[model samples]
Target: MARAPTTADAFNAVAEPRRRDILNYLALAERSVSEIVDALEMEQPSVSKHLRVLKDVGLVDARREGRQMLYRVNALAIRPLWEWTTTFERLWRHQLVKVKENAEKKTNL
Candidate 1:
């Protein structure tokens, strides 16, 4: 089967570690490309590439501010990814409970 392009959806777009890092940074506040490059210690071109992919997938929004372009995460566009991951939250909680019970049993023995 053919693999989907990173720009195809939020999932594919965020699959890249760099893209995730970009999103995390943008989560805090909107920033210019140079700000991201300096903060993340990445090359300007690389950051720009990742931002383009994220924007194409609607995971991010970019606007011209003065002479530079500022980028920010689009929370609404991330809803599907958030909803999907949350489904696993219950499983994680259940596993944690089981682990805690096992630890208590060992401690009491």
Candidate 2:
């Protein structure tokens, strides 16, 4: 089966590393296309393309500020992603505790 495009949903949209980076950058503050491009060290077209995918998934909001467009993360839209991933938090903590216990045993040996 062919893989769905990144614009399909929040999960797919954020699956791309570059898109995740873009989201992380935008999380701090709104940024123009050029600003994203420069901060990410990506080409202008590439940054714009990622922004378009992010927008389609509702993970980002874009607004016009004079001739420039500013983009920011849509926190509400990202909640689903956060909720889904955090479901594994407990499992991760359990595993970490096991590892810590084993390390402590070895150090005492």
Candidate 3:
């Protein structure tokens, strides 16, 4: 049997839609806080707040670039989510196959 996937604080960070959107945006490339705020057309405080949560969960990494800090996706942090979700996908597919077979049998009867 496969071992359980590692669960990180990332789950909580992704609970909010805004945070998830931030992750998607970051996937393209690292950006400074100001850059994110500008692209999102949201207040600086709001952007910073989301970034704080993401930073706490290890889904993103930040470093000082000049006077500003830039953030980027930390792929390793979400590995567990990917593993568990893929497993769920497989389980759902199997269930659907069985349901279809049962329906076909009933129709044939």
Candidate 4:
């Protein structure tokens, strides 16, 4: 299947590790472009480019805060991605339960 453009959806935008990093950082608190650049140790232009994609996909929102642009995660826009990933939550829980059972049996033996 053709890969969707990063701007097409929150999932696609976050598929890039650096973009995910930006989102994770913003999840803690809103940050200016320079702050994101500093936290991620990424070049300003690269951070800006990823931020543009994230903003385009609605995963991020930006507002002018004085002279700087502050970016933050849009939780509502990210809900779809969260919902999709959580579909596997039950499956993960089941597998973890089995592992725990096996470990208990070994310890008791």
Best TM-score among the predictions, by candidate number: 1
Scored by CA lDDT, what does every candidate get?
Answer: 0.94, 0.93, 0.86, 0.90
Clash pairs detected, candidate 1: none
The sequence of per-residue lDDT tens digits that candidate 3 reaches over residues 5-94 is 222377767878888888889999999999889888888999988988888878889999899999999989889889879978978999
Residue 33 shift from truth in candidate 1, angstroms: 0.7
In the range 1-109, model 1's lDDT, one tens digit per residue, is 7999999899999899988999999999999999999999999999999999999989999999899999999989999988999999999999999999999999999
Off by over 4 Å in 4: none
Question: What is every candidate's alpha-carbon RMSD to the true fold?
Answer: 1.2, 1.3, 6.2, 1.6
Better of 1 and 4 by TM-score: 1
**lDDT tens string, model 2, 39-107?**
999999999888999999999999999989999999899899889989999999999999999999999
In candidate 1, what residue range of length 10 has the lowest lDDT sum?
A: 1-10
Model 3 / residue 88 / CA error / Å: 1.6
Runs in model 3 with CA error above 4 Å?
1-8, 98-109
Candidate 2, position 87, lDDT:
100
Comparing 1 with 3 on TM-score, the higher-scoring candidate is 1
Clashing pairs in 4: none
**TM-scores of the models, in the order given:** 0.91, 0.91, 0.77, 0.88
